[model samples]
Target chain A: MLIHELLPLVGDAQSVVEVSQSGDALRELLRAPAASAYRAYVPDGEKMDAGTVVVAFLGPKPEAHIDAETVAPALRELPVGGRALLLLGWPVPELPYHRLLDELVTAGLQVLQVVPLDKVSRHGAHCAVLAARVDRLAPLRTHLSDAPLDLAGEAPDLRALLRLTGEYVFGDLLSRPLRRNLAAAGDRIKEQDERIRALEKEIAARDATIAKAESRLARARNDLADLRASTTFRIGNTVVQGARRPTRGIVSVPVGLVRIWRKRGTPGERPGPQS
Target chain B: MTLLTDAEASKYWNERHQQETDLRSGGDISFDEATNYMFYLRRLTMLMDRVGLQNNPVAPLYLLDAGCGKGYFSRELAKFGHQVDGIDGSEAAIAHCRELGGGPRYHRTTLSGWRTPWLYDVVFTVDVLFHILDDAEWERSTRNLASLVRLGGKLIVGDWGEDGDHVYGNYQVVRGRDRYLPLLDACGMRFDGWEPYRFRRSPIGLYTFTRIG
Candidate 1:
């Protein structure tokens, strides 16, 4: 997701001026360690200086054209020898990278380097980086009309073709699998994280439940033990045992009753203690 | 007269449910968005606490989520060991609820039409009745929801906790406390005090009713 291709240009820059409709590209730009002082600007009514790094993010809309009118003013502000890095959200068939380069050259910026930033940038858009040096402008008597550019063959010229090849190698071939694997791994980790959280919650709930049940069981056991040690329980036990003796069956109840009466009549006859 | 027919209501909900990817997506009210999801999460948790649904020792509380769309609350309550039945008129919504498989039985029936041999210990309808445009149908739905609750059990309704009902967006009949209390009284359900939902940005709150008979 990090456009490693733009690292070299950005690695040495101290101050970066980012122009984009959304601050997303600017935020990504500021992530580089080289960007100690980075400020973002919108294309409308914005001013910039030359000799500093400038990044412009354009497109995702093929229907919308990026003309010299939009690109020239930003470049004009850049002083001589200033670096301009143009990143397109995606390649529009109508506005090819080479045509954009031609527009920049016409606008008084010397084309230095043109390459695809990555096959797919963090925004899920194809991006190309065009690093140009601002130079003294030749006075323009006439404005160039928007016209389809021809680059010799079915493909763009060797310079553009070479950049395209680099795009395939560095952007698609190198980063695609890495991105896929990282995404899969991230998803797996996230799933496991969610599962772990759910399990922890469940375990905590079960522990509470078990503790409650254990307390309840302890209380029940204590109640049962208390019942066993009670005076009433001893009298009932004695009567039952005495009744088991067949010879004394008729007198067993009276004897047991008298014994309980004597126990109750005794001084200091506490119910549990007497039992 | 019913402004929106039963068929119209079902179609509206079914289409809306089908479009949504989750419980919080594709409605005028949504929780799928991050901010809205947070709001809904807080509101539901607070509502549960207010209704004594959180850490409830009274497990296996047979709960009826009347007009349960997509079974968010039903599934959550079922997690707390309550046997929940989620009823919705939208077939798509019921199907989606069944797919979630969180242990709540899904029934495709409107509140007025819903029938069961067993009564629920806690029957609740959250943010569902406002969509019923017909006044008579609303009364019937209220009565039917009350009927599903056992005596001394609760029937919690979610609506505006204001004095008088108002209609919003041609469908949502914001039933106020004044409108609900008499209807609940008629059905032998006692009007317990309303507990306002803590995180709701609006005046909506939990309308708790207890069946006395």
Candidate 2:
């Protein structure tokens, strides 16, 4: 058995040669005979006429390093019944390994097995391997006829079996405990909802306070404007003070009794004012 | 001091001033002094407000007055919380600007020789560049103007448009708005905006350019 590894250094060597530059390390890695078993980088998809078993060592970091654009294009070029081995450097916790295996099977690939490679030297870097044989490329071509549930023809029976099992096992042994757990979860959810409502109310109150302050500021400005208009104060230039013009003429008095007449008139005026 | 020995430029400016003085002193002007002064003051205040001078009370702004003949605009800008430096090649004009208590630092220099130790936020050259006699001087003057503006700063220019050149009183020169764009582009300057201004009943155009990388 010949084991081969296609280690790409610079350009993507899949369906199309997307990158223009080729690194020296990739050239050295491709010198071995087993490497000759795989097709080299080619730009056109139709030109990939070699390679039976295609093993794609996606990269050192599966999710972070591997280019999905390159991989998806490569997948389209694979021949039927040909094997494709995808080694992912990171394990997906959300996607169960069995479900991924089942998806590959549903996609017309017979999944031989998925293994967590612990003993392999390359496995020093965390990795998962999926070995699959392409059975039919168009498994999902006929949805009604070729669907997984339709092919099984026993999904209804399976659901009935599960219902019966739940009724017997859970009702007999663990019904009360399960109900208690569910009630506790419900109480936690209600507490969270109350906290959310309190936050909403607090935000509304803050907005109202802000609006009131803004209105008060506007009123204060209007009052200041009115005060400025009422106050008619001018600074600088002091000509408009208590300065009066002199009366035009003085009255003529008799020569002999001029002083007497002046005194008498002043005295008479004073007396008249008193009366 | 870098003075222009060009006889045409000197004669042109002298004739221009004579014409302006003649016009201003010719009529029995019935302008309300108090109202006019108040209006000018309000306009200065508004300009200061728009430029955000109030926010920066401690540090003074640096302004460049290009083609600053007698430094009227330069002095006004300095009064509004800016430290101004004005350059005009005409020696008599610079002397008159000094006598007017225009506190802005004045220099008797042509646009070609104008240099500064510091960059300015705004370079204001009003009714000046149109006096350039030829294309070479215009290009040189424009490049010098753009060089004075710091990154993200403005260059404000007011001049006679190409259409208004024939309506000259003392000095004669003409330029259009479209002519300035290519010259400014060569100097790594981009057009920001423009406004139409009429001074002493004569139509003038104002353009602004921002220095960009």
Name the TM-score of candidate 2: 0.37
Can you give the TM-score per candidate against the true fold?
A: 0.41, 0.37
- State the weakest 10-residue window (summed lDDT) of model 1 chain A: A139-148
Model 2 chain A lowest lDDT segment of ten? A140-149
Question: Which numbered prediction scores highest in lDDT against the true structure?
Answer: 1
Candidate 2, residues A22-59, lDDT tens digits: the string is: 23322232333433333444444444422333444444
Evaluate every candidate with DockQ and list the scores: 0.00, 0.00
DockQ of 1: 0.00
Cα deviation at B141, candidate 2, in Å, is: 1.0
Worst 10 residues of 1 chain B by lDDT: B50-59
For candidate 2, give the lDDT of residue B184.
Answer: 80
Query: How many residue pairs clash (N, CA or C atoms closer than 3 angstroms) in each of the candidate models, in the order given?
Result: 3, 1
